[model samples]
Target: MTSADARDAGDAEAFPTVQLDLPVPTNVRVRTAEFVKSSVEISQCPKEGPPEFAVIGRSNVGKSSLINMLTGRKALAQVSKEPGKTQCINHFIINDSWYLVDMPGYGYAKRSKDQRREFDAFTKAYFKQRGTLAMVLLLVDGSIPPQPADLDYAAWLASAGVPFSIVFTKADKKKKGGPRALSNVAAFKRALLEARGFPLVPPSVVTSAATGDGKSELLAFVASLRGMWEAAKKRR
Candidate 1:
């Protein structure tokens, strides 16, 4: 059977529930500021005491929109009509205590083979090498059925041993009880089924940049991870 077919038939019980309290990303508590992008500095992302939550997803998957939603700002990550606009890692200091990293999206574009290759190399390096990345929120398009490329990338992350979770974007665009959302999440599970040594897999959260869904759950998750890291550093 094809991998996707097998996945579509797999049991849901095998996937454990990740506890999360969904919260809206509101402007009242969101004090966001965008910082400059420096690939060199990105290498040292975790050097500081604050924990970093990095967001990565496919090109034009409303990544910038999500960031703006989370920060309660109109245009924090620079929304653009073109794909592959975010060529570098963008950092935002939040509440002067933590950071939100805006990573370049993967898959699809009209770029030449060389540019695509360069992007692949750069993004792979960032995920494999970034030090202070406490949590990586990989955004998924909840408005459509699962794409093969998304599954492949999820498996890649599993194999690479990177910590990450699924964040479904643009849920407002999806019809309630839609097949698209189910397919997208099912695809994610299938990819993760092959992951080794990645115990305690994180939970997937649904969000809408327009409605600000899942904002609280995401922040709480990040805050929890930050605490764990802090405790570990203290022990060292």
Candidate 2:
């Protein structure tokens, strides 16, 4: 069988549950997922309100692959070999329950100045203004040490008071039986801790689209956040 087929077969079996160390329950399952809409601006996004979790990262960080893996849909989010292909805010409604938003990749040096400015403005506005936004899933390449752009974005999100979680992608790319990915994750966390001058760190997960590692945990994390969002909405 092809590798993709193997990954699919593996997903069919029971996988280990993701331990978030949070009080939220992680029993939720995704029964159905459908592409809802793609919008250039957050204002153009779907009006039917559901708690939305957005995924973003530097260019070519495997954000699309991770999204597809988490939802068990191969082509749901177009996986491109080229970086910066996703220039719009793409929304996928999951089980008619919540929205999975795919935001444009940042830190591509080839992008025009105007394009970068546009993305910056829109991204900042979405984070600052989107009331239904539950959390941001920030994907980072796990095979290498932390990049400055990722660190800067994390700091920016913290300053903006935006809720987010770190997802280390491409774990399968790490050397066989090596701890390079884990070491990178640790270094990134230390940088964040040092930069923020605090002991608390954002929730994080390690993932690989090829082997379906951390798929269950990532989904469980989303499920827990969605539950919290629903409860908060009811209280209001």
Collision count for each candidate, in order: 2, 0
lDDT of each: 0.70, 0.80
Worst 10 residues of 1 by lDDT: 20-29
lDDT of 1 by residue, 42-92 (tens): 455445556678788898888888888887888778888798877777778
Error of model 2, residue 120, in angstroms? 1.8
TM-score for each model: 0.78, 0.85
RMSD of candidate 2 to the truth, in angstroms, is 6.8
Name the lDDT value of residue 20 in candidate 2: 45
Model 1: how far residue 34 lies from native, Å: 3.4
| Residue ranges of candidate 2 with Cα displaced over 4 Å | 1-27, 175-182, 196-198
Against the correct fold, how does model 2 do in TM-score?
0.85
